[model samples]
Target chain A: MASPPRLRAENLRSALAGPFDVSVAAGRCLAVTGASGSGKSLFLRMIADLDPNTGEVWLDGRARSAFTAPAWRRAVAYAAAEPGWWTETVADHFPDLPAARAMAARLGLKEALLDGPVLRLSTGEKQRLALARTLLRASPVLLLDEPTGPLDEDSVGRAEALMRERLAGGAAIVMVTHDPAQAARIGDEHLVMRAGKLEPP
Target chain B: MNPIVLTPRDLAVAAILLLVDAALSVALRLGLTRALGIAAVRMVLQLLFIGYVLQRVFAIASPWLTLGVLLLMTAVAAREVAARPERKLRRYGNEAVGLIAVGFATAIASILALTTALRPAPWYDARYAIPLAGIVLGNVLNAASLALDHLLGGVVREKPAIEAQLCLGATIGQAMAPLRRAAVRRGMLPVINQMSAAGLVTLPGIMTGQILAGLDPIQAVKYQILLMFLLSGGSGLSAVAIVYLAGHRLTDARHRLRLDRLA
Candidate 1:
């Protein structure tokens, strides 16, 4: 039998989202598309255990409860739609400066941008940098909430390419996106969320 | 050199000072006259009541009675601490946390001072213990309340940032470290300022009273220095304890930022 999927959610339910059952294997991506308030973000948040939710999530066949919350979150990382930066400078947020610089370069961000204060960055720039911050973790499962929401077409393409590289390295991805074309391009399986339930498009 | 005793007639003379403040409120339409009158009456009544109680307690000098008064004072201070914050924990969580911190810090500081520094005969002597505990409780109450206010407000304002840190695989302690530090510092600020300004900008109340009671200036300064040390130490302990306790309440075993816990 094939090995268990890298990330599996079985009957995950939260107040605002999910009774969601989904699976994404290693080297594949599950792209979720939904309207503005269809609970796409909340679904991913439940999978990451960022919000209070019921039911089970398994990583590499082990239950979410088996690992500590921090460890589970480390392996199953969630990048928020508008991620927060607590520090004044961008460099303070990243543990590995050179790796962040490389990731920034790949995401079409300038090296100088990494050294400046985060407040000065545009929304698009902040979004990409946040993605870079999450990507550095090399988590086995990546949950991206509208990762390319504010990026221009060219930048979006670059961000997608970077995610594809993570997939190539056997990291499973569950992404929430608004762009059907982008989802079609990068997603191994596409699901539409409506009223907290996922359905095939 | 005995202190001059002020009779009721002399006290009435001192009460005349409020006329200037009342006149200003009336003329400026600050609308504080009612509040001012009520507050002045309350202060006089409360102080007189406390003086009577302390006089009786000193005569009895019973340890149980002394402890009872201290606990009563702490409960009142804890309630004050709980009510000062704009945002509060649901139920009386803030009050419970404040009581624990203030009670613990006050006990430790007063016990240490009485045993090692003052060495009052029969250490729990009402005269020494009541006044010292009162002073420590007053400072600890301020610190605990201020720290709680800062933590509750900070948690709400910085929710996103805190949640972001948790998302990045941070434990609750790690996520809350900066906020805890900021809140404790905010709480300790008043005592810090008072310590730095003591004898330079202003004579602290206790020392001023000691001097007025004809204690030697140098001896009064020594007592003031000791009291300042106790106040600062108690404030720091209470601030740290209250912030950590409140922060713990704001999060959970799963390290999630439980914003629902706050009201």
Candidate 2:
């Protein structure tokens, strides 16, 4: 029999989104798609424990309540659709400049992008850099919202490739996307959110 | 040197000064004429009441009375500090914390000054303790309020950045470090400016009052210097303490951003 889910959510309900359940096994991707304003991002946020909700989220069979918010966040990383940057230089966000450069390169970012200030980056660049930052966290479970929304075809491919590498490395991923073809290609299990309920695609 | 005492006639002459200010306000349509009139009445009433109260309290020289006055001032200061934040603590939360912080800061500075520089018989002399505590409490209260206001505003404005840091595995302190630093700098700005401008752009109140009361100019300046140093230390301590205390309240034991605590 396959092992239990690496990330699990039971009865997760926000005021806007209802009591939903989800489970993703190791080395698998669960893609959640929904219409605009359909609580897709809210669902992702609930899983990441960023928003207030009623639910039990289990990581590696351990309840989320067992971990501090910081530790839990470290285990279950979140990449927001509209990411926030605080520092001036892009390199300031990363722990290792060379490693960040490598991740940037993998994400199709130019080497010089890391040296420039974050304000100078394009929306696409900022999104990709945010992805790089999230991935650098090395969490076991990843929650991504519109990871490719701002990207070009080449960068989307690069991002998908990176997600594939992580999935192959036994990390569980719950991604929110609008593209059906991308879902079919990358998702191990696909769920559509309608009227705040998760259903089979 | 005999200080010039202001009699009733002298005070009436001083009241004419308000007419000049009122005239200017009326000419400029500053809308401050009524405010100035009300303030003049209020200042006279408040000062007179305090003057009588101080005379009675000093005549008795009771430690209990001295302590009561200090505590009352601190409580009032705490309330003033608690009132300015947009995101207030659950009723009396910031006020209680403010009380303790402002009280402790005022006590430390007052005790140090009273014991060493200007020690009086019986230590808790109303003349020394009450006035010193009032000055310290007033300055410290402003600093604490400014710190909390900046902190609340910063947290709201930088919610995305703060949440981003938390999502990246940063602890509450780690996520809030930049905001806290900025808040502290902003909170201390007025005090810092006062320090820089003292005797240059403006004559500080304590110095001007002392000089007018016929103290030697050099002696008044020395006392002013001492007060400046005391206020800097007291305000800095109160500002930092309030920030740290309030910052902790903004998060939970799990180090989550309790943005809901904010308005």
Candidate 3:
């Protein structure tokens, strides 16, 4: 008998999005592309249970409802495109400073940047740092929204390599992006979101 | 010493002081003349009505009557607290939160003062309990209302930061910790200022009233000091209670930021 998919969303519906059903196996990446208001972000939020939605999401055949919201989020981590910073300094957000520094270096960011105030970082720098922060969790399933939207070619390549590394370690990824070429390069399967529904591109 | 009694003629002479305020409003085109006149009339009527009610209650000296009056005062204060906030909880949630915080703090403070400090004959004596409860409720209502207003406004303003914490696997309480602390601090600020300024920049109202009623200056000062401590303790308790209750109401069992709960 075949093993159950690593992550599965069945009949997921939110106020602004969904009625979506999809499956992603271990060690695979599913790239989603959509127009600006196509509810791509909302879809990811519903899957992570960050918003109020009606859905059944399963990780390794375990129901999302079975685990507490925080536990489920910890297992299925969502990295927002424009993540918010609560503290004044960047170092306060990360639990392991050394690990975060390593991840920052891997994402083409300066290790010294971590010690400075968060307000000083540029938009692309903040995006990369946020990705590093999320990656440190090493969740079994990763939900990424426009992770490379603000990065340059070199930075994007570094980020894609890092994501591929996670995938190789048996982590499933669902990424929302606008760049079709990048999706083709990084995505095992490409899907387009239109009017809150996913479709084959 | 016996205090000088103010007759109806004395009050009519006092009414002339408000005419100066009305004249200033008219001269400045401040559009407050009518409001000032209505407010003056309302204050006189309300104070006179309360005086009459208190006289009857004191004459009867019944516990149930005192309790009834206290509850009525608390309900009215709770309504006022709930009404002050711009972003209110939906369907009387604010009122309920206000009542719990205000009622609890007022009761605790009043009972402590009446039993320990004053030692009124019955302890639930209307003369002591009603006035003390009224004073404590007045301070607590302000603090609780300020805390609720700050919290509701902060939740809306800091949605992104709060949601980010929730996404990072924080429980509702953990996520809202900073905002809650800030709201409580904001609520307690006024009382802190008042306490610091008492006997220095300004004499508190209770102390001034007691002195004017021909009580010994030292006795009035002691009462004022006792009141300052009680007011601070009561305000802090109410502020903390209301902020936490409102925080729970804003989130849900699933730890989601339920902004839809606000009206």
Q: What is the C-alpha RMSD of each candidate to the true structure, in Å?
A: 1.7, 2.3, 1.8
Q: Residues B111-217, candidate 3, lDDT per residue (tens digit)?
A: 88888999999999999889888888999999999999999999998887787778788887888999999999989999999999999999999999989999999
lDDT score of residue A7 within candidate 2: 95
Model 3: CA > 4 A from native: none
lDDT of 1 by residue, A1-201 (tens): 889999999999987887999999999999999899999999998998878999999998999999999999999999999888888999999999999999999889999999999889999999999999999999999999999999999999999888999999999999999999989999999999999999999
Task: Report the C-alpha lDDT of model 2 over A83-128, residue by residue, as the tens digit.
Answer: 9877888888898788889999999889899989988999999999
Specify the highest-TM-score model's number: 1
TM-score of each: 0.96, 0.92, 0.95
Candidate 2 global lDDT: 0.87
- Which lDDT tens digits does candidate 3 get at residues A1-201? 999999999999987888999999999999999999999999998998888999799999999999999999899999888888878899988999999999999898999999999989999999999898888899999999999999999999999999999999999999999999989998999999999999999
- Runs in model 1 deviating more than 4 A are none
Poorly placed runs, candidate 2 (over 4 Å): A13-18, A35-38, A52-55, A194-196, B90-92
By DockQ thresholds, what CAPRI class is model 2?
A: medium
Q: List the residue pairs that clash in candidate 2.
A: none
- Per-prediction DockQ scores? 0.75, 0.66, 0.72
TM for candidate 2 is 0.92
